[model samples]
Target chain A: MQELGSFLEVLISGLLAGVLYSLVALGFVLIFKASGVFNFAQGAMVLLAGLALVRALDFLTRLGFPGWLAIMLGFVFAALVMALCAFLVQRYVLGPLINQNALTMFMATIGATFVIEGVAQFVFGSEVYPLRLFPTDAWIAAEATFPGGILINKLDVWGGVIAGLLVIALALFFQYTKTGRALRAVADDHAAAQSVGIPIDWIWFVVWLVAGLVALVAAAIWGTKLGVQFSITFLALKALPVLIIGGFTSVPGAIIGGLIVGAGEKVAEVYLGPFIGGGIEYWFAYVLALAVLMVRPQGLYGEKIIERI
Target chain B: MGQFKTSYAKDMVIFPIRQDRIGVYLLLGFALVLLPLMMAFHVPPFRTDYFLLAILLPFLILSLAAIGVNILVGYCGQISLGSGAFMAIGAYMAYKFGTGISEIGLPPLPIVFAILLGGLSAAFFGVLFGLPSLRIKGLYLAVATLAAQFFFDWVFLRVKWFTNYAPSGSVSAPELKFFGYLVATPVEKYMVALIFVIVFALIAKNLVRGNIGRQWMAIRDMDIAAELMGIRPLVAKLSAFAVSSFIIGVAGALWAFLRLGTWEPLAFDINRSLELLFMVIIGGLGSILGSFLGAAFILIVPIFLTVLPAELGIPITTGTVSHLQNVIFGGMICCILIKEPLGFARLWQIGKEKLRMWPFPY
Candidate 1:
């Protein structure tokens, strides 16, 4: 019973952590679905957003703004910057290099990754800053009656709630909103959407903006947990395996894949890590994704890819 | 029109034009003779300064690795992010073979053989990680390769056997000797790297120009069509992986033995993989000349950035310089992709064409 309780607690914590992974993976899926380009800069975008927000908050607070007002202003500034980034990316990168191969676009994003990281470091400096958006102490205390007691971090719980809400909101927006429908049409077939008189470039811009918003949320959650640092960019790499397992174009796939990877790594680290000298979490998600991909090339929820020669 | 080949044998030569052949021979001759001549004559930069030699050695090693990556990514179209892992395998395996063999007190096998063995070991692991390419491709294959990168990193860091059970988990190359001649000095190391680069570059050029190279190009263009045309995807893809890994592994061994005499696992991390990929992309994807060009550009720029400020008596810190370097390098990559996606090799080709048609717009 005690072992089972401990396992349950670990599983819950892992799932909670998975929510953040899902948020980052969602950013990748949004960009990929619309543009068919793997944005390697997505991680850098997360880091940039977090760095911008924290710096903005710090600057605002130092100027005698209220805590709540500073937070609100920081978020608004981040949103504007992200929108500007989307526009600039469209103008400088996508517009000029239209109809290029996927690999070329992928390479461009890598360049964008370096630029974003450099800009972030240059603007905000490379110092590690603790994000105090949420309370540090766990809100839920362990009960003595339960075996090993199950303590839940309030920040994680809120993170899970926020992630769930974001996913739901996105789903509704995609299903109901006109712009979202256009975005879907674009993702479905770029030529078809363009032929139908849909504003392909505008849709792309909006999609990138949405992805940026998702990146901001993800960074916020991750920053609260790990603190804002250069290493946070690496945490974004965790989303890659999540995307692979979830399928590149599937929104729900990102969520499920994130959960699987997050829980799977935690479980592996706990049960199998000690024997192997720990740090197995780094590669565990990738290995799992690879194994799963062998069975389902299109991924668990990804649409089957059909090639006609 | 100035020079014409009369026979098919003459036409089939790697450099059919006499001028082209002369130019290539002159370049090779200069490379072979320049450093040794400079050292003998006590030339200022070559004698008093080891910095140029230091940069050249890694540039040569990285060029070789980039060439390997080019075969896989450019020629075969299998995007791999695990080149660093293969490099690690080569380096550690070479370290093991080099140290383990010497400990046994057998007749000392040449360092060249140990390096080859290190490359072969890397090839073995490359094939293992490459199995997923059969099932998935493109971005999926890339992520799978990332797994290999992380896995090898963990293995080299955690598994003590690979590092010879050192307390710090870092290993240094044993004395690199070729038949009792120690290759210890910077010039000797530079020569060693240059020799490997030249030999491997020749092999890569020949391989790409032949039947195997055609198979790889066929697969890269359209795998299904290649299969329909009797080119086995399995053999082509795996061979590409094997050959690419072999070259990369040798480069990795050279990197350990020639440069950075002592190293840890962090030396061959994801950033290294990204740097090599950038070299291949920025150099030219399918062209061998691009590999050398890309390697040279990536290696020299950082040194230049560091030294330029000092030379100008500027007061910038190293961190700021590095940060600015990243920004500039990143911007350059984007500019190259946008302006000339075919990279420097294509630019070189364009220059040559313009030279041929000088003073004639047509």
Candidate 2:
């Protein structure tokens, strides 16, 4: 029973962490569906966004501004930086090589990733900066229901709430707005979207901007857990496994995939890690994703790939 | 610039222009005779151990690895991110062959044969990992190959027997013995690497121009059309993975034995994979000469960047230098991908074409 209680706690925390993964995965799905570029630089963008926000917040705080105002202004400044990044990427990096092969596009994004990582680190000191946006404590509840009270991290719960809100907001944005419908049209068929008078370039820019914003929001919450540092970029690697499991194109898939990965890896790390040595989660997630990939090449929620000669 | 071939044999000649033939002969002569003499005689600053060990040795092996990568990615159209895994397999397997045979009654395998066997073992794993390429395509396949990268990385780190139970989980190269001759000096190591690189490169160059090469290219360009034309995707794709892994495996052995001499799994990590991919991309996909050009570019740019700043008496921190290097390196890759996807190979071909047509503008 104690084991079961601990497992549930682990599972809950994993699910919470997984929701944040879904948040990052959301940004990737946006760019990939719209651009077919994969945007390997998405992780670097998060690092850049996080650094910009933290550095700005630090400066504002040092100037003796009120806490709320500093946070608000910092977020605004970060969003502007992201918008500028979106414009540069869409216009300069991805625009010229529009019809090139997928490999070329992928490589270009990786190049962009290196540049972003380097410049971001160079500008903002490569040291960790703690952001107290969320509670760093834990809560003990349901003590009578489970042995020794199921422990829960307050930060994880709050992060989950924020990630959930962002996902809902994004879902609404993608489903209802006129621009959202146009983005879908562009994703469906680029040439057709252009022929129908949809501004393909504008739609692409909007998608990139939205993707950048998603990363920034997630970075805000995640900054509290891991601290804003260069290691924040590794979140992108974790997101890739979630991506394959959830299917590349589906929003809901990202959530479900994140939950599975977060819970699955957390559980495996505690239980399965001991006998065969620890630190299996990294490759365990990949192996799980590969198994899923072998069974369903497209993914659980990804669109069926149709081929014509 | 002009097609003046009278026969099929003439059309298929390695060098179509007279100057190209003379240029290659002169370059080979310099590498073979002049360079070695300069090194042995300690001629100026060109023949130091640092020059041989740090620059040229790695240049030869990395260029070879780039060709290996080009065969799969550039020619075969099957993208793989598990190249570092294949390299690890080659390095570790070759190390095992060198030391493990004597654990039983048999004598240890010769180093040269161990290297070849290492390549073969890597090829075997390559085929194993390449299995997914049959069903997966494009970016999906690229991600799937990550399975290979992460899996082998774990295997080498955890599996004790592969490392001959070294305490540090790292292994050192055994003797570089060849036919009762010890290849001890850096110069000797460079020569050995040069010989292997030249042989394998020629083989790669010849193979890419043959029927199998055409099949791989066909599969790359349009798989469905190639399938319709009776070019079996399985054979072409697997064969590509096999050949590419073999070449890469040999390069890996050379890298471990000749370049580092003592190394850990960290030596062939994800960064190495990215570096090799950069070489292939910046050099030009599907162009063998581009492999050498790309390797040289990727390898030398940092040295040049670091040195040029110091030479100019600009006192910059190493961190800042590295950051600037990253910006420049990555920007170069993006520019190359956008402006010239064919990369340095295209630039070289254009230069040659211009030279061929110098006397006549049109």
Candidate 3:
């Protein structure tokens, strides 16, 4: 019973961590669905957004702004930075190479990743900063008559709730908005959408902005949890396995995949890590995703790929 | 503009044109005579700058690895981000075989034999990781291969047997001997690397031009169509993986033994894989010459960046230099992709064509 209780606690924490992973994966799904380009720079964007927010908050607080106002301004600044990034990416990258092969576009994004990371490090400086969105001393726990009590970090719970809200907000945005429908139309058929007088470029810019906003939220939550640092970029890589496990085009798939990967890695680390000298969490998600990929090439909920010669 | 070949034999040679053959011979002659010529001439930079010689061996090794990656990504159209893992396997395996550190009391093998064995070991792992390629492809295949990178990193770092129970998880190269001569000096190392580069590059060139190369290319262009045309995807894809890994493995052995001499698992991390991929992309995909060009670009640019600020009478911190290098390198890659996706190899071809059409308006 004690073991089971501890397991439940670990599982709960893992599920919360998975919510943040879902947030990052959400950015990838939005961009991929709208643009048909896998944005490798999303990781760098996360780092950039977090760095921007942290620096802005620090600056605003230094200027005698109240804590709440400073935090709000920081978020506003992050949103603006993301909007600028979307504009720049569309203007400089996607605009010129509009009809290139997917591989070429992928490579271009890698180049953009390097550029973004360099710029972020240069501008923000490579120092770990504490981004305390919530008080660190607070804990939320369920009172249960187990051998040891289960303790949950309130920050993690809040992260999960906010992430859930963001996912719902995005889903509704895509479902109800006219712009969202047009975006879907463009994703379904680029040329057909263009012929119908829908501005493809404008839709792309909007999608990138949405992805950028998602990146900001992910970065904020993740950065607050584990101090804003360069290593936060790697957390974005953790989302790739999630993206693969969930379908690349499906938003819900990203959420489910993140939860599975997060919980799976935690469980494996707790149970199987001892036998394997621990640190198996690094590759467990990937191995699991690979196994699933072998069975379903398009992924669990990905649209079926059709190829005609 | 050029002499016509009278016989099919003359036309069938690797370099049919007399001038083209002469150019290649001259290039080889220059490479063979370079060190001796520098020594005789008492060249100040060559004598004083150890960095120049030091960079050469790794450049050659990385070029060879780039060729391996080119085979998979460029020829077979299968993107693999696990080249570093194959390299790690090669390096560790070579260390084991050369040092006789295995469970079996194996005699210390010759350096060449050990390196080949190391390459074979990497090839074995390559085939194992490549099993998913039969089912998945493109970016999916890339992620699958990434599993190899992470798994091997964990193995080399955690498994003490691979490191011979070294406390630091680092290994030094065993003495490299070839035909009773110890390869220790920079010149000797350069010669070893050069010979390997030439031999393997020729092999890659021939492989890509021949029947098997065509089969790999067919699979690359369209696997289903290739399969329909009686070409086996299994054979083509696996062989590409095998051959590519073998070459990459040998390059890894050279990198450990000839270049670094003492190294840890971190040397062949994901960053190294990305750098190798960048070399292939910048050099030219599906072109052997592009590998060399790309390697030269990747290797020399950093040196140039490092030296430029110092020469310009400006004092700059190393951190700032590296930051600037990253920005410039990233911008260059983006520019290259947007402007000339074919990369430097295609530019060279165009230059050659222009030269051939010199003195004519057309």
TM-score of each: 0.97, 0.97, 0.97
Candidate 1, residues B124-217: lDDT per residue as tens digits? Answer: 9888888889878888898899999999999999998888789998899889897688987777787788888999999999999899999999
lDDT of each residue in A194-218, candidate 2, tens digit only: 8999987788889999999999988
Please write out the lDDT profile of model 1 over residues A168-208, one tens digit for every residue: 99999899999999989998888899999999889999999
Candidate 1, which segments miss by more than 4 Å at Cα?
A140-145, B101-109
| Per-residue accuracy of model 3 over B1-362 as CA lDDT, tens digit each | 67788898777777766777899989888777876477446686677437446577778899999999999988998888899999999999999999885478798788999999999999999998998999888778878988889889889999999888999889999988987899877877888988999999999998998889999999988899999999999999999999999999999999999898999999999888988888888888888889999888988878887788789988877777666767776777888888887788889888878888887949
Instruction: Give the count of colliding residue pairs in each prediction.
Output: 0, 0, 0
Candidate number that wins on lDDT, 2 or 3: 2
lDDT of 2 at B172: 93
- For model 3, how big is the iRMS in angstroms? 1.3
Q: Among all windows of ten consecutive residues in candidate 3 chain B, which has the lowest summed lDDT?
A: B45-54
Model 3: clashing residue pairs? none
For residues A1-309, could you state the per-residue lDDT of candidate 3 as single tens digits?
778778888898899889889999999999889878888889989998999999999999999999999999999999999899889888888778887766777778887888888888888877898898974454535546666677677887888899889999998999999999998998888889999999988999999999999999888888888988988888767888898999889999999999999999999999999997989998888898898898888878889888789
Q: How accurate is candidate 2 locally (lDDT)?
A: 0.88
Alpha-carbon shift of residue B274 in model 1 (angstroms): 0.3
Worst 10 residues of 1 chain B by lDDT: B101-110
